[model samples]
Target: MGPNVHIWRHSRCRGAGWALTSPRARSQAVPGTPRHPLVLTETAAVSLLNCLFLPRVAEAASLPSALPLSASWKELVAMWLPAGKASGRLMKNSSTSPLAEKQGQTSMEASSQSVQATSGYPSTSTSTSTECKPQVLPVIIPILLSILFVACLVLNSTSLWIFWFHIKRWNSSLILQFNLVLMDTLLIPIVPLMVTYFSLGNSWLFGQFLCQLKIFILSTHLYGSIYFLTLISIHRYLAVAHYSTRTLWKKKSFLKKLSLFVWFVLCIQGLPLFFVLKTSVLNGTVKCLSIHQSEFSSVYLYYSIFLVTISFLLPFGISLICYALLGAIIMKMSSTSLRGRVMKTKSLQLIMVSLAIFIICFVPLHVSRTVGVIVKYYNMSCKLLLQVEIAYYASWVFTLVNCCLNPLIYNFSSEKFNESFSKSLRKFRFFK
Candidate 1:
């Protein structure tokens, strides 16, 4: 006798999900939505109806054992109309009577409102999505992030100290490495807050401004580190394979200037995050910089794709090409001395480690995040979106590993710096 049943029985077309309304309800527009509603041919009404009403209908009346699960609309009427004369009359008049039409229209309006309230990429308000909760994030991501923070802080601080005070000679490669270290170190102060946030079940205690600042710093660190690693790869390639570029490689000023440019570009890229990265109080807890905290537009989706392409993909490709070429150049050399073999071994190690960072850290992070952005904008199913969210967070945790692994690059790429770092480590009683 409910209006919901009348709306579905009178609907002329089918739709995906539990759309208990006419086709007109599908055209309701939200952010990132097209002007026209996307039509889906799969019928969900029967299943939804059976799921919602069948058990009660069966329990109220003595149902036949031969009742088919895929009962037609008329069959459903026959099965349920016997339960009560009132419901039977209501069903009979639902199509032809004006009052029934009015009830169905009212039901359509209510269902449309519910759909619009729940669907879309998240907006400025808190999300009510219960299906998209990540099960492993609270346990896995916080532990990984904490371990990464400790390891990266110690390694990067030691590297920074060596580069600043112990190693007197600075070249293009050292300049690049030092800049990379600075990026990693800059991220150090932000990690504990993030760890605490994840540890406390994604609840952020910090205010909105710090939330935006945290996201900005994280973005800057990720892309800045990628840029410097690519630069290091190219510099090493030129230094080892092309003797003619040695003089250029010896000049540190060019790299310093380039580092400034990189930071400027990163700042430009991260500036927009402040507007979109907002904190929302959900279930009385503040959630910061969550994908669910803001609405996504078509423009934002395109920008995210562009960022993934340029910031992550482009640098990863360049690093791969440079390392491949370096590998080839190292292979062609016929040197048999210990020093030559040592350099060759180190070069190969650098290639593997750098490629590991790219593959493990950058690739999945960008791909999963970009896919998640697309899925969110298109308002995909909660299960698919949940999978993407899991992948994105896990890959993001892997990205922090790069900060710990990058110090290996300094040791591999430069002999003098490596010796200095070794001596510094040996001075510690722990290393001794």
Candidate 2:
């Protein structure tokens, strides 16, 4: 081939003509044979450009059909050619060699990009993952949990030591409070694990079995504490309000049997957790008890409802009634004597603290969790579901406060335990 023919063939192959030519130059580059082949008429160039770009643009932008020749050519000029010296440089480069190949490579790259976009490959997956998985739990959640973990560890440990060592005599009230202490103690170790999970942004490093076990222990502590508090309130109410039942309330045997029954019931209630509580991985992070609201099952909804009613609602009612009656009875009791006034004050303290636990801790958790389940089960809007989920998790974090507060129940339940605690505290310089 001759020099002009070689240059023309090279420029055509590299798509350099699209950038270099202009409407005013149409007469110079006319359709002709290869011997004089520095020629592509406007119609031929338009058809060639459409063939090169239409499929890619259509797929990328979801266009219905090819744009008109004038519109497409104008857009193509706008895309590849810059103004002033840049256009001159592009023309010079096309007339030469290497830059034309670069232009062709850039076109190939753009086509590849459109193909990638059409196939849904790049930004879509990342955006979806970010939208689906929560960014970070509320800052206060881990903070409060860490505080509770420390408080629960200290208070429950002290209470456990006092009950086991300092208090020589064990009455039914002390026994019941000791069981509450046991529940708190059992739950204390789990709190730090929970804090770690939240601190790591809701990742559960523990395996599936441990996840189920963690939830199981939490559930057990929750309902177990509720039942124990209810039993304490009932026993106190019967002892104070109904004099004949004082003998029954004082008997450790009856309380032990009742405690055993509570444990059995709690065990039965926890069985479902082994099935429902699972460790799931979301966007490569392992999660436990962090199930998305939309993924909840109908069966889980029903189970949650049943669990809340029996474990929370019933005991809550019974405890409320018991405390109300006990309060009334204590109020009516003669406070003329120092002993009577002190006894009344202690009883009042127990009533207030237990009520605080029920209201501040249990009620919000049960209400939020139940509402979350219902909203999820019915396939509600994600907005409402997310609000409920936030409420539920917030309540869950606050409910752990009960472990730290149960020691107050122990303190207020019996005068002997209080005396023993004071003696133990006095032995240390902190209480001095």
Candidate 3:
């Protein structure tokens, strides 16, 4: 039953008074026995084999001779031996034989290990590395990002078309919104790369130079976005708060120059990024940390404060104030004096709605991440895993939302935006 083993046995036949049956092959066959290889009756063969090979049977009978030898020993041995040997021959050593099994196991384990070691996410890999299969974001993140990227391109393309063709280019509000659309369009493509990188848990899948290039792009876009947003808010403030002010901050030429200055300043502000980001291994995964080491924490903090204040908080505050004031002024305007004044007021209301959405989407993420990063520096603990996970997922959703919201924001919130967009559509349809 276990494995094939060779068995050697002998048997004798004895008859008495023509009885053809005898208990001992003359067990008493000559009391002084020559130790012939033990003769076995069929029963004795099975029993002897079991006793020598099977401890249970052997333990039952202390003496081998104690086996009850049948009168027909020859027939019994003939019946069982061949069958048992054939069964042994047919037995699968692969499953039961220890040496054979161990070898097979070794082969299987090796195959599995090699498979796991091979390049992971065949969806992403140029070549297979089956031996070291670890779950990586490089394989998955790009996919999600690519999907969003395409969507952003399509949506923002519509906005861009409107900005280029339909916008009057004279109305300061229209000019302002057109610039905002242009800035947002420029910002969309960078997301896929960031998504790929973040998907790898902040690991920079792109090489060192590309890594720095990406960070530069990211910082520039961030600063640029804040710059344009602040400009949009300032434009609204001039139009609504200082209604009929002597100077036109809304003038197309001034707005163009302002946009150029914003780009220049953004490039300058993002330059220091080259010094901070470097490739490093985090928990055995390669990542781009803010610095080569914590020695630069102070510097990173200083930059972060500047960015959060000047780029995020200040722009957000200014936008809120501008919109709030516009809403108040629109309410105070003479409904009888102006045609469609209420509709124009509704545009300001739309801008307010868009501003609220932006705050709702991004503010929580910045707050939690800032807290966790600061707390982690002083006391790293498992308790923060929940907060980190929340911030991470929230940031992703927030970013994805930004991709599609620009056009809708203009269309729904700002009537001036809708007017610009509709005019562009009309020109394309009629002229082409």
Candidate 4:
């Protein structure tokens, strides 16, 4: 508008889309600067150049009068943003930025003030846990998991002792339930330390081989828990449902053969993890882990989940149905006394506890962990440690709950467990 404010758009070179901020840089102008990219008069383009991308080395480094933001954005525009074919970045920025330019000066000042506000005021609220203490977590979470894990193991061990020595001298039928307890006693010790490693943000201070071994053992034990519970359900169903039928021990060697088979498969099942799971460093923190590393890993976590349902959950559900069916059969066959009713009711109650534990301690963990694995394998950027921490921390509690709950499962399922446990107490009482 003013005579001295010359809005003259000049050419840097005829074909070049150079938008120089400095008047001296464009002092040697070509015939006519292509003005469409800037969408601005020379004066407005100069104003934007003055306002934003200049100050930092504008004096020292002479750039093209106009350059695109990146080689990629330029390529993208050329390939797609049709306007770039006719004009260039300066024109596009100038045309789009008039209202923005007016507000930008105000907003940029406000932004700088906000940053300074944080520096000056300092947060007065002590209740806010804004401070990050990743280092402290490794040292602390282990101690807590260790205490809880030990408590769980102690319960499982007591359950095992009752099953092993105190329970009535039945055949291997009762021992099926006890195996759950035995596995928990054997399996749970590795967890507190692993939880500590996980709490430390997945960094494995443990060596490479230990990392693989830990993952293999953890996976094996977790799956073993699932298998044993399923076995107990089937064992109990067979006993009560087919009371008139042949005993499990008397026919087909089902007791010994089946026990050997389940463990044999579980041992083989763990072998894949031995090769795949490893210590990984991400964002400078080490994590002992696996997220479908191979085609195998993807196949394993998901397909196995489906397989777990088909082989374990669905079968267990069938066992529950059979238990209910058998209870009805018992009610019809003999309504003689309260003792008969009490025994059948107790058997049903035991199976209910078994089902409850799986739903309570396992289902949530599987759902959350599967979601995490999907996001991770797809390489989405949102793997924030805080999110990872929350997800994994919740998962461990459930998963470890699963690891430790088997003893109660055994006690609930077997009647021999009650008589034998009482006898053991009597023997110990006499010794004292």
Please name the candidate that would achieve the greatest lDDT relative to the true structure.
Answer: 1
lDDT of 1 at 84: 48
Best by TM-score: 1
Ranking under TM-score, best-scoring first? 1, 2, 4, 3
- Candidate 3 per-residue C-alpha lDDT over 373-420 given as tens digits, one digit per residue, 9 for 90 to 100: 554445444356445644554555565556566566567545656887
The C-alpha RMSD of each candidate to the native structure, in angstroms, is 11.8, 14.9, 21.1, 12.7
- Per-residue CA lDDT of candidate 4, range 1-432, in tens? 211112112232211223332344355344487522223234434443433333322322333333343334344334333433334444444465576565655555554443235234444444532332232234454655676687787777667777655654656556566556666766665776576675665567878898877767766667677777766666666766666687754343576677778788877877776775666655566656634233345755675566456645675576567667756766675547886676577676766676777787667666666665555555444535336546555566666776555655555555577666667668879999
What is the TM-score (0 to 1) of candidate 3?
Answer: 0.58
Q: Please, what are the lDDT tens digits per residue for candidate 2 over residues 1-432?
A: 222223334544234354334444445454573432234554445544445544444444444333354554566566433432444554455555677567666665555454344334464334234243445678788898888788888888888888888888787887788888888888877787888898898888878888888889999999999999999998888777766554777899998888888889988899887777688777788888763624446777888888788878999999989888888888899999997898799899989999999999999988888887776566566677677767877897779889877878777778787888888877886756
- Report how far residue 175 has shifted in candidate 3, in Å: 3.7
Tens-place lDDT per residue, model 1, 1-432, is 455545445433123343533364454334485544333222344555444344444544545423453566686567566764544555665556788678666665555554455454233324434434433354878888999988998898889888999988776778888888899998999989988888888888888899989989989998998998898898888878876655666678877888899999999999887677677875567887565444545766887888888888899889989999999999987678887788789899999988988888788888887888787777778788878877877887898999988988889988878999878877896756
> Which residue pairs clash within candidate 2?
none
Error of 4 at 137 (Å): 7.1
Give the distance in Å from residue 27's predicted Cα in candidate 1 to where it truly belongs.
26
Off by over 4 Å in 4: 1-144, 163-168, 198-201, 247-252, 290-316, 323-338, 380-389, 425-432
- Cα shift from native, residue 410, model 4 (Å): 2.8
Per-model TM values vs. the true structure: 0.70, 0.68, 0.58, 0.61
Candidate 2 Cα RMSD after full superposition onto the native fold (Å): 14.9
Candidate 2 has an lDDT of 0.73
Name the regions of candidate 3 deviating beyond 4 angstroms: 1-147, 198-203, 289-295, 334-343, 412-417, 423-432
The TM-score obtained by model 2 is: 0.68
